[model samples]
Target: MDHREIVTSLSQEQRDHLTAKSDLPGLPLLLSHWGTILVLGTLIALKVPFWPWLMIPQGILIVFLFTLLHETIHQTAFRTAWLNEAVARSASFMLALPADWFRYFHFAHHRFTQDPDKDPELAFAKPATPWQYALHVSGLPVWRGHVKTLAVNALGRCRDGFVPPKGHSKVRMEARAMIAAYAVILILCVYFRTPVLLFAWILPALIGQPFLRLYLLAEHGRCPYVANMLENSRTTLTNILVRRLAWNMPYHAEHHAYPGVPFHRLPEFHALIEGHLRQVEKGYARFHARYLSELKLASRDASK
Candidate 1:
């Protein structure tokens, strides 16, 4: 069946059922999310015998909060609007991403998933060479982009075509507030002469960012420039733990297809669209290997 046929086959009742938002699983999910962080934090605070080893998991968890941020931007993380906003702001702050700015930026991404010129995400396409891939995976470029975005937006220089003029004030205010908050944290760290922030936030994020970059690259990395979500996006078959951590984002084609279907309901949506999906990968590892192999072949062909 074609994409439109697959979408039209679903009755209104089924659509409503899939789109119905609720907090049924969100509460427990949030608990588990924070619980993991608390456990890692406590272990770090106590300086346990193997505390250093804990950093890997801690950093992974910390950087993976970007998934939560992405979910909140869709306002699908919780049934309650305020809960979504609160979590979005918190996750944005932790990741140094501006929530207001990201909402529009991400919406643009959803609107134009793979449009070479229109999709802001396509501004920096996936790496086609080994050196480019190495740099892309390093997460340094992402950090630099975020810093520049925040600084410019804070200066009331919001020029992104996707961001509405009416929302520019909010974007500027959010950036300025974020800068102030970071300043306060820095001041507190200096006054207390403590490395708490370093161990707790900075170092962990730095260590964990590359993993996030690797995971994100598979989303639409090698997909063709097409309007069909099922074709342009990729759905990765990953383990339950990774699914939970990513808030079921591994079903990415399902997401780009019907973004209104909340995180809790994506698996059901996937079941509906599974046969119609054109881009499914077994796992991130397999996806990466295939992507690199193809890039290498392309490089050799170009040289020839």
Candidate 2:
């Protein structure tokens, strides 16, 4: 069945149950995520034996906050509106992403999933060549784009069609505030002659970004460009740890099909529509391996 049909087939009671929002499940998960980050950061700060190695997991945890940011923007991470907004803003700052701007951008993506002309994500285009794939995975392009976006938005010159005029001021202010906060952090670090942030946040985020790029690519990469969410998005069956870190976003097709369903309820949602999902992947590793093979084959075909 198509995505719309799948949704329509669900009874009102089922729909209601799936869409129900609650903070109970989110709070503990949030605490555990943050608690782990805190512990890792402390270990690094103390320069424990093989402390540098700890950055790997630390970076992964920190970078995965993007998932939290994504969910909170939808206001489905928690039942409380304020809690969602608060967590989104925090995650945005940590990731150097402006929450207000991203909300419009992400909403447009949902509205026009895989639409080459309209989806902002398509503007950058996915990596086609092996070299390009390496660069994409390196995360440099996204980092550059984020820095540029923040600067542009801070100047009140955001030209994205998705951001309505009413939100321009808010976006601009949010960008400016983020810039100012970053500046303060930098200034304090310099004044203290410390590399605390460099070790604890910056390096780790950079180290963790490639993994995020890989995970995010699986969400829609190579999926058919169609109106049906079931066809246009991919659901990667990943491990429980990854699911916890990503807030169940591994269920991308289920999400695009029924966005109102909160993250905590995604597994249940997946079970109901498992047979209907069109672009499910076994795991991220399998997806990337297959994707790489396809790229190589395409390169050879083009050369011929």
Candidate 3:
């Protein structure tokens, strides 16, 4: 069934229960996420034994804030509107993504998911060959894209179709503000003559982005370009830790099917519609394995 049909199939009571929002669940999760980042950063700052290695996990946690940013843009991360706005702005700064701009881009992605001609995500081609996949996952392109978007928007040259004309000013202002903030940060880092920010934030985010890339690819990679959300999005069956890190975004198909359902309640939503999911993966590892195998097969066929 299509997304609307699936929602319509649910009883009113079930629908109401699933869509209920509360701030309690999200607050603790946000706090714990930030707390973990703080602990890791402190260890790295203190230069504890094997401190360099700590950046790996540190980076993972930092980059995964993209998931938090994603949730906030949808305003489903918390019931409180101001909380969502505040968190979205902070996460966006950490990721070098402008929240106001991303909201428009992401909403358009949902509106035309997997549509080759329209989806802004489709503007960047997915990696097809092994070498291409390596470069893609290296996180280089993502960083480049973020930088380019920020620069262009700040210059008031953002011609992205998804961002409305009225929003152009807001997007421009947001990008300019982010650039100024980054400048201030860089000046402070230089004046202090310390690499604290470098080791604590920059390096970790760089090292951790590939993992995020891998995780995000599983969402719609190789899924069919169809109208049905269940068919178009792949829901990866991941472990509890990964689920928690990503704010249960692993239940992507459920989220796409019913965008109103908050992050905290995705598990229950998944249970209610588990049987209907068409592109479910057993795990991220399995998904990547199958994806690579298919890519190899396709390459061989093309060469023949």
Supply the TM-score for candidate 3: 0.99
Compare candidates 1 and 2 on TM-score and give the better one. 2
Clashing pairs in 3: 59-204
The better candidate by lDDT, 1 or 2, is: 2
Instruction: Give the alpha carbon lDDT tens digit for every residue of 213-271 in model 3.
Output: 99999999999888789999989998999999999999999999999999999999999
TM-score of 1: 0.97
lDDT per residue for candidate 2 within 1-304, as digits (tens), equals: 8989999999999999999999999999999988998999988988999999999999999989999999999999999999999999999999999999999999999999999989988998898989999999999999999999999999989999999999999999999999999999999999999888999899999999999999999999998788999999999998999999999999999999999999999999999999999898999989999999999999999999
Clashing residue pair totals per candidate (backbone < 3 A): 0, 0, 1
lDDT for 289 in candidate 2 is: 99
- Where in model 2 is the C-alpha error above 4 Å? none
Residues 41-83, candidate 1: write the lDDT tens digits.
7788778887877878888988888999998889888889999
Q: Against the hidden reference, what TM-scores do the models get?
A: 0.97, 0.99, 0.99
Total backbone collisions, model 2: 0
